[model samples]
Target chain A: MEALVALSIAVLTASGVWLLLRPRTFQVIIGLSLLSYAVNLFIFSMGRLRSNAAPLLEKGVQADPAALADPLPQALVLTAIVISFATTALFLVVLLAARGLSGTDHVDGGEGRQ
Target chain B: MSFLADHLIITPILLPLLAGAAMLLVNDRHYRLRAALGLVSTLALLVIAIMLVQLADVPAGDASLGRAYLLGNWPIPVAIVLVVDRLSALMLTLSAVLALCMQIYALARWHRAGLHFHSLVQFLLMGLNGAFLTGDLFNLFVFFEVLLAASYSLVLHGAGQQRVEAGLKYIAINLAASLLFLIGVSMIYGVTGTLNMADLAMRLPDIAAADRPLLEVGAAILAVAFLVKAAIWPLGLWLPNTYGAASAPVAAMFVIMSKVGIYAVLRVWMLVFGPHAGASAYFGGDWLLYAGLATVTVAAIAVLATQDSKQLAGHSLLVSSGTLLAAIGTGQAGVVGAALFYLISSSLGIGAFYLLIELTERNKTAGADILAVTWEAFGEADDVLPGEEEVGVAIPATMALLGISFILCALLIAGLPPVSGFIAKFALLTAAFNPEGLGATGEPISTTGWLLLAALLLSGLTALIALARAGMKIFWMPASTRVPRVRLIEMAPIGTLLILCMVLTVQAGPVLRYTQAAAEELFAPESYVESVFGAPRAGELPQEAEL
Candidate 1:
């Protein structure tokens, strides 16, 4: 499970970075989304892989910390996910605006005579 | 008053946040109420910041635990904590003053150029204040995003072809940096199992030997993320374009944004890698020093080459960031104190310069700067004698005011004599060259010290020349340019900012003394950790919940 997660993160990051370097704004936006997904998973996996374990404890019950899944990383990952989502939406709007104003989809707004 | 003082630490963050949310509800057509809302909130913030500074200054003895407020009345280690130490209070005060001045300046005309200007400025302030006051890394990331989001919208506020293009690059770069921030943060969490800065510091020295390299890698990546914001060398190439394309008030408000990165680096480096961190002490100190010098060199050269006044101010920001980064890298308490002084002086000067540029360049044709450069290159513009201009033609008040403000800004940014800039550089060089304090002098300065001295002196020289040439082109050529239509409302903010710089010059002794004390407290992290751990929870905890 650990190897699979790590391998997927690596692949996503690689492809995302490759796309990010492309000239088209659409590709860059897609790249950012991919990169953010990788980061979110990386944050989530930091808690160490646990299956069939509770993320919380009863109000008055005590349990060894190792028996329960680490909840802090879960919370951190959730925040990261929301923030990335908003930023991606904002980026898309800007990308579309740039395309309209500059008359190109290239990242540097393309080479065109004004 | 006593009750208010207890909660003063949180007001800087909360006041702007509430104002921003409320301002969003108001119609943008109601400019009067929106302006008044911004004004009242910023004025109140300035007052609260002053009170917080006073609170931070109370001598807490050896146990100099700063004022720590755990949110939701939770215990320190696990809960989000807001700390008001001398360093943070100083930053809060600086940002408040900048925000108030920028807000007033925007009131003249710039605020009408876009929607939700007031709310964006208020939210930007909230982000900056939160970044400074938060005591945990995760909260820092959140505040960082908050500021970046506001800045993105603010940069695109007066959306033109240039602004949109520049804004695209700026947002993309920062979004990448944000991802890096998360990666580094999560890596650190994996290693340390704690995100609270104080708790991490307490636990770093005891980590297993096998895990040390992982921690260092995490820290190095984190530093890179911050250095991008601080505009260190290669990572900072986007700054001049982005800042130059931003509107005047937004760019002025952004003068403190770079410092946020420097502040983060300083706080994290001192707490997590200071003397008590054992084997991990000063993990990346050498990298900081060299990279800082490189940034200074490149920025200074770029300052010489920059033709536009707005771009010149942007380069000046890079210069200040580099100097502060190098000073912090030195790891000397005295140097850091002087760096703090330099930070305040340069930020005010740059902020004023950004505002001044819009007014000064208000009437010039778009190609005037390039044409002037060409004329100078061809030696067509001769040096006009003082006697030539004295043919019974008195200088107009607008010209005189603009010229005087321009010269003051040049002097301040160039670190020339007769302003706080000179004093700041003097103090920085003095402390850096003599790191052993007064009594322990006579140890020869290191090679890095010599390099720093050269970088600073040379950078100042370049800045002086660039500013002088730009000033002459703008002011000396009366035939080619018209006197910009200046308004009292606009002029007063620039005057106030310059006057504050002068005040800093006059009160240098007391301010330096305060910064020195702050530096001393920063270097001693035991008190900070103790304060965090010692902060009382609001109520008794359940038996099972007790640690």
Candidate 2:
């Protein structure tokens, strides 16, 4: 399970970085999304890959931290995912605006392309 | 007053947040209402920040009393804590003062250029104050995103073609940096099992030898994320263009954003890795020093080459960041104190300069833009003649005031005499030279120290020449340009910032003492950890066994 998670993260990051270096604005946005996904997964896996464990405890029950999945990293990953989503939306709008203004999908606003 | 003082640490974060949310609900057309609300909240924040400083400055003997407030009453290490030590309080006050000034300046015109300008500024303040006061790493990342999100919108506030272009690159770069921030943070948490900074510091020493390399890798990655924000070299290429493209007030507020990165480096590096962390002491010290110097060199050269006032200010910001980073890398308490003073002086000076740029360029035609483009394409527009010379127009009174402000700013940026800049540099140099002041190890100044000094002097010289050249062209060489119609509202903020710089000069003794004390407190993280965790609960790790 650990190897699979690590391998997937590596693949996502490699592809995201490759796309991020492309000249096209759309590619960059997609790249950012991919990178964010990898980051979110990484953050989630920080809890040490717990399975069939509760993140919460019952009332009046003493908490056995070792038996429970760490809830903090899950919360952090959730927050990060929300933030990345909002930022991606904002980036898409910015991409469209750039296209409209500069008449190109290039990241440099077609400054050097011309 | 006592009640207010007890909750003071949270007010800086909460006030701006609530005000921003409330401002969002107000109709966009209701400019007056939004402005009034922003003004009241910022003014109140200024007062609260001042009170927090006093609160944090409680006598050393009574230091353990009334500082750290654990949120939700969860015991130390488990709950989110808000600490109001001298450093956090000082940073909060500086940011509050800048926000108030920038907001006031924006009210004159920039606020009307876009929807929700006031709200975004308020939200940016909320992010900044939260980042400064939060005691946990995850909370810091959350606040960082909040501020970056606000900045993304604010940078595009004016919505010009240039702004949109620059904004795209800025957003992409910062988003990437944020991803790194998350990965680094999670890695650290995975290795350490904690996200609270003080708790991490306490636990770092005991981490098994096998996990040490992984922790170091996580820390180094985290530093990369911060250095990108701090505008260290290679990673900071986006800064000059982005900052130059931003509207004046937004750019002014951004002067603090880079410092946030530097503050993180100082706070986290010094606390967790300083002197403690048995195997990990001085982890990234050399990298910070050299990269900082490289950043300084790049900024200095850029300063010499920049044609526009805004770009110059941006490069100057980089220089300031580099200097602070290098100083912190020295690990000398006195140098850090002096750099703290320099940080305040230079940030205020550069902020005022950014504000001054728009006013000075107000009178120029499209000639400035043409010159900028030509320089960009051809790398020096010597062939281009000075655009049509007009007959001499009578110089307005505002011109002289602006000229004086420009000179003061130039002097400050260049680290010339008779300002706080010179005092700061002098103090840093003296501390570097004094072997006794270089911590208890008493190590002699290394080659890096000499390189830093040379970089400082050379950057100052480059800054002087650049500012002089730019100032001469704008103020004196422009034969017949019309005087920019500066308003009192605009002039007042610039004057206030300059006066604040002047106050730093006049009260250098007390100010230096304060920063020195702050630096002392920062270096001695024991007090900080204990204060946050409480005296008795700090070293007791039985709870950790249960966990």
Candidate 3:
């Protein structure tokens, strides 16, 4: 299970970086979203990828530390996801504005002949 | 007053947040009320920051190293903590001073140029304060995003073609950097099982040798994110364009933004990788030195090539950042103290220069730059008609104020005599050359030291030449320039900032003492760790608090 999750993250990151280098703004925005997803999964898996384990403690009840999954990474992942989502939205609006003003999708504000 | 003092550590962050939200509900047309609100909030922040600095300036082994505020009354290492030591307090004071100046300057015209201008400024201040005071790494990330969001809006505040274009590149690059920050942070968390900075520091030394390489990789990636923000060369290519394109007040506020990266590097590196970190001691020091020297070299050359005063200011920021980075790379306590002093002087100068650029360019024709360059390139002797020169006319009052301000700004930026800039550079150089308290060691200066010294000296010289050339064109040339209608509201902020720099020069003795104490506290992390962990949780005795 850990191997599968790690492989998926690697693939997502590779593709995202490739698209991020592309000249188009839309591609860059999509690339950012993809990169964020990979990061989210990576942060989630940092808790050692436990299966069928309780994530929280019962009130006034003692629980074995080994039987429970690490919960901090999950919280961290949640925060990362929310921030990335907002930034991606912000990036889209900026992309549209840049296109409207400069009349080009290229990142440098110049028309690419290619 | 004592009750307020107990919570003083959190006021710098919360006051701005509440003020910004309140300003949003008021109608934009009610500019007077909004401006008043913004002023009150910023003034309060300045006062609060000063109080915090005094509170944090206590010597080591004092009962309370600083005031630590834990949110939600949770236990240490679990709840979010805001720790204000000497370093954080010093930064808070600088930030609050800059924000107040920018707020006052923006009131003249820039605030009306966009929606929520005052709110955005307030939010940016909140982020800066939080980032300075937070003890958790993840909380720092959250604050970083807050500031970046506000900055993006501010960069495009005027909605000009140049702004939109520059804003596009700026947003994209920072988005990528944010991703890198997350990956690096999470990787470290995975290795250490902790996100609190002091907790991480405690855990670093105990990590097995087998996992050390992963830890180093995470740290290096994290350093990359910071270096980008710090405007280190190659990674900082976005700064000149973005800062050059931002509105004057926004650009002025951004002078502290790059320093945020420097502060983070200093805080994190000293805490987690100091001498106590076993194998990770001084990790990435060499890379920091080389990168800083390269940034300085490039910025100096680039400063010469720019005709626009705003771009020149941006490049000067890169120079300041580079010098600080190199100073940090030296791993010497005295040098870091000098760097802290230099940081204060240069940030104030650059902030004042950004505000001054707009006023100085108000009356000049758009084509004046092109005309000047053309005249220099091909000798335009025909345009110099005889006897039409008004060389001996007394300068207008407006022109006089602008000229004096411009000259003072030049002196401060270029590290010339009779200003804090010269004092800062002299202190930095002397400290670099003589590493005091090293047990009478006669070791020669390393090759890196020579390179750093050369970089610092040459950058200063380059700034002097560039500013002289630019100033001559703006203030001394025989161009058909009209006297700008300067407002007292506008001119007062610039005067205030410059006066503060002069105050720094006059009070250098006491300020240097404070910074030296702060630097000493920084090199010794045990005190910081103890302070964070020693704070009492609500409803519990101090001695009962535990992880």
Candidate 4:
């Protein structure tokens, strides 16, 4: 399970970097979203990926660190996910506006064309 | 009054936030009301910030260490905390002053250029103030996003083709940086099992040898993310283009944004990896020094190359960041204090310069437009007639005021004498040269110290020449240029900032003493750790037991 998660993160990051290096704005946007997903998963895995374990503790019960999952990383990952979604939407709007203005999807606004 | 005093630290974040939301609900047509609310809120923030500064100055003892307000009254390390010390209070005051001045300037005309400008500015304030005050890493990330998001909207406020292109690049670059930040943060949390900065600091020393490498990797990645935001070389190439393309008031407010990155670097690096980090002490110090030097050199060249006033201001921002980074990399208490002073002066100077750019460019463009029309009406050959000899025209009062302000900004940026900039650079160089300033070990000054001094002096020279050249073109060489009709609202903000710089220069003694104390507090993080955790209550079984 650890190997699979690490492999998935590596693949997503590699693909994101490849796309981010592209000159097209749309590709960059997609790249950023992919990168953010990888990051979100990475943050989630910070808790060490416990299966069938609760993140919460019962009232008047002493917390067992070995049994329960760390809830902080989970909360952090959730916040990151929401933020990334909002930013992605904002990026898409910006990309569309850029496309309309420059009449091209190029990141440099077609400055290289001439 | 006690309740208000107890909760003073949170007001800087909450007031602007609630005001921004309320402003959003107001009808768009009633910009007047929105502007009034923003002004009043920012002014109140200024007062609160001042009070906070005073509160932080009063030493609350080794236990409390200057007021740590845990949100929801939860215990330390569990609830998010807002810690206000001398450093945070100083940052709050700086941001509040910048926001207030820029807010007033925006009301003049930029607010009308776009929808929700006032609200976005208010939101930006909330984000900036919160970032400065928050004690937890997660909250830092949240506040960073808040500021960046608001900045994205603010950058796109006065939409044009260039503005949109620049805004897109800015968004993309910042998003990538944010992703890296998350990865780095999670990696640190994974290794250390904590995200509260103080808690992380307390736990860093006890990290097992096997996990040390992982922690180093996380710190390195996190530093890269911060360096990118701070506009270090290579990663900062987008800054000039983006900041130059932003509208005047937005660009002015953004002066604080890069400083936010620097603040995080200083705070986190000093706390987590300072001399107290044992084997991990001064991690990534060498990289920061070299990258910072390169950033300074490149920014100086860019300053020399920039044709427009806005791009000049942007490159100046990079130069300021590089100087501070390099100074902090030196790890000298005195140098850090001097760098902090320089940071304040340069930020204010560049912000005022950004505001001045719009006024200067407006007249220049108006003059050029007239010239183009006249030349078109006649023939190109006739434009070169002997009767059309170009020479300096009579300057108006507004032009004179702008010229004075421009010179003051140039002097500050170039680190010329009789201003806070020169005093700051002097203090830094003095501290760098003095062996005693190299900490209690009295380590001899290395070649890096001399190299940094050279870079500092050379950058100042380059800035002087560049500003002289730009100033000649804009202020002196213009023949029969129309005087820009500067509004009092706009001019007053520029004057206010420049006067503040002057005040900093005049009151350099007390201010430097304050920054010195702040730097000492930063270097000795034990007080900070003790204050946050509150002496570790009996039967708590240690906070690290949760890990």
- Which candidate comes out best when scored by lDDT? 1
Tell me the docking grade of candidate 1.
Answer: medium
Report the C-alpha lDDT of model 3 over B219-315, residue by residue, as the tens digit: 8888888888898998998998899788888999999999999999999888989878999999988788788888999999999998878789999
**Could you tell me which residue pairs clash in candidate 1?**
none
For candidate 4, the share of real interface contacts preserved is 0.96
Whole-model Cα lDDT per candidate?
0.87, 0.86, 0.86, 0.85
Per-residue lDDT of candidate 2, residues A1-114 (tens digit): 899999999999999999999999999999999999999999999889978998897666778778888888899988999999999999999999999978999988885863
Superposed by TM-score, candidate 2 places the C-alpha of residue B31 at a distance from the truth, in angstroms, of 0.6
Q: Please, what are the lDDT tens digits per residue for candidate 2 over residues B204-223?
A: 99999999888888888888
Q: What does the lDDT read for residue B160 in candidate 2? A: 67
TM-score of chain B of 4: 0.91
- Encode model 4's per-residue lDDT on B319-388: one tens digit a residue: 9999999988888788898889998999999999998877776555434642343223223222322233
Candidate 1 error regions (>4 Å): A112-114, B62-66, B366-396, B539-547
What interface RMSD does each of the candidate structures achieve?
Answer: 1.3, 1.7, 2.0, 2.4
Candidate maximizing DockQ: 2
Residue A9 lDDT, candidate 4, scale 0-100: 90
| lDDT value for model 4 | 0.85
Model 3 CA deviation exceeding 4 Å by range:
A112-114, B63-66, B371-396, B437-441, B540-547
- Candidate 1, residues A8-98: lDDT per residue as tens digits? 9999999999998888899998999999999999998988889988899877676788789999999999999999899889989999899
